[model samples]
Target: MKLSKRLQQVAELVPEGAVLADIGSDHAYLPVYLVEQGRIRQAVAGELNQGPYESAQRTVREAGLSHLIEVRKGDGLAVLGAGEASAVAICGMGGGTIVDILSAGRDKLAGVQCLILQPMTDSDRLRKWLHDNGWRIAAEELVVDEGILYEIVQAEPGDERYKDSLWYEIGSVDLLKHHPLFPQKVSAAIKKIGRVLQNLRKSQGGLAAQKREALLQKKKRLEEVLKSCKQR
Candidate 1:
């Protein structure tokens, strides 16, 4: 089955020979594809809603991967049991939602070596949570598909901190790997923060002032990144 560029990037991050659990697995395509390629021996496709749950089941059955992939219906990591998977892939969800899921089902993460996260929004919050909780980012990927940019972060259990605050505020520069869209990503971030600063400037509240200050700092960091990219 064909996967979107975003999902394909997520799939490529999964470690070979590791069992995987694809959370919010819309059609279980990632797990099925991995299994077909012999990248993983087993997988569990978890979906929260019934419609997608049934659809996942159908997909796995149609792919004739019923023995290698199990489609289960439950919210977040609740569908998984301890030691059931070595890696967890939670994609196409908001960063705040992903944080809640990880926090809620943290106990199930025992023995899990890796986490592949693709947050649709507020990824900084998710990264902060991971850093504070001891999940060091092992690798990261950024891909733009159909004019929409997406980030895929692969983290494993460890303790690590960024030398520059921009690593967290913006993202890991080392992980960007000089992607062709690096400039575009930096430009887009600068524009997004510029809009935030504009809106915050019009507001007259203590929180707004603080937010504006933070955004200004972030904007500068992004600009520096953009400049450095141009220099290279």
Candidate 2:
């Protein structure tokens, strides 16, 4: 099975020989690919909707991996048992939704060693959530697939000891700045966040003012990153 570039990057971040639980496993592609590649022995492909759940089952069966890959129909981490999976992958969702799933399924993460998250939006919020809730981002990468720039974060259970002020603002800039697509991705994010700041500047209220201030700070950080990228 061929995984998208984004999903491929996510799979690579999974620890070798891990029992993976892929939440929101649309077609169970990642798990199947990993199993076929001998990267993982067992996997749980969790899907919330009936259509995708059936699709995942079919994918596993067609790959003759039904014995190794279990297609479970449930929401978020509810389909997982404590200590059942060493790594959990949640992808193609908003950062807010991912955070909600992790928050709601806190107990299910007891034995999980890593979280590979690909947030479709609100990534900054997700980063903050992870940091505030005692998860540390061990590695982060950006991949451009089908003309879309995706950010994948690999997090591990840890205390709030690591601090990076630019994490949410520019994302692992120091690590990813040399990537071929880094400049384009950073430029796009800066423009999007700039628009957000513009809208916040137009609104009138204490909340709007507070948001504007926060966004301004982020914009400044992004600008610095962009400048550094240019100089490189």
lDDT of each: 0.90, 0.89
Candidate 2 lowest-lDDT run of ten = 161-170
Instruction: Give one digit per residue, the lDDT tens place, for model 2 in 1-232.
Output: 9988999999999999999999999999999999999999899999999999999999999999999999999999999999999999999999999999999999999999999999999888888888888888788888889988898989998875336666675566656778777788778878988888877766999988888888788777778877888888
In model 1, the clashing pairs are: none
In model 2, the clashing pairs are: none
Model 2: per-residue Cα lDDT at residue 10:
94
The TM-score of candidate 1 is 0.93
List residue ranges in candidate 1 displaced over 4 A.
200-214
Best candidate, lDDT-wise?
Answer: 1
Segments of candidate 2 deviating more than 4 angstroms: 161-164, 196-217
TM-score of each: 0.93, 0.89
lDDT of 1 by residue, 1-232 (tens): 8888988899899999989999999889999999999999999999999999999999999999999999999999999999899999999999999999999999999999999999999888998999999899998888888889898899999998888767775578877737667778889889988877777777998988888888888788788888888877
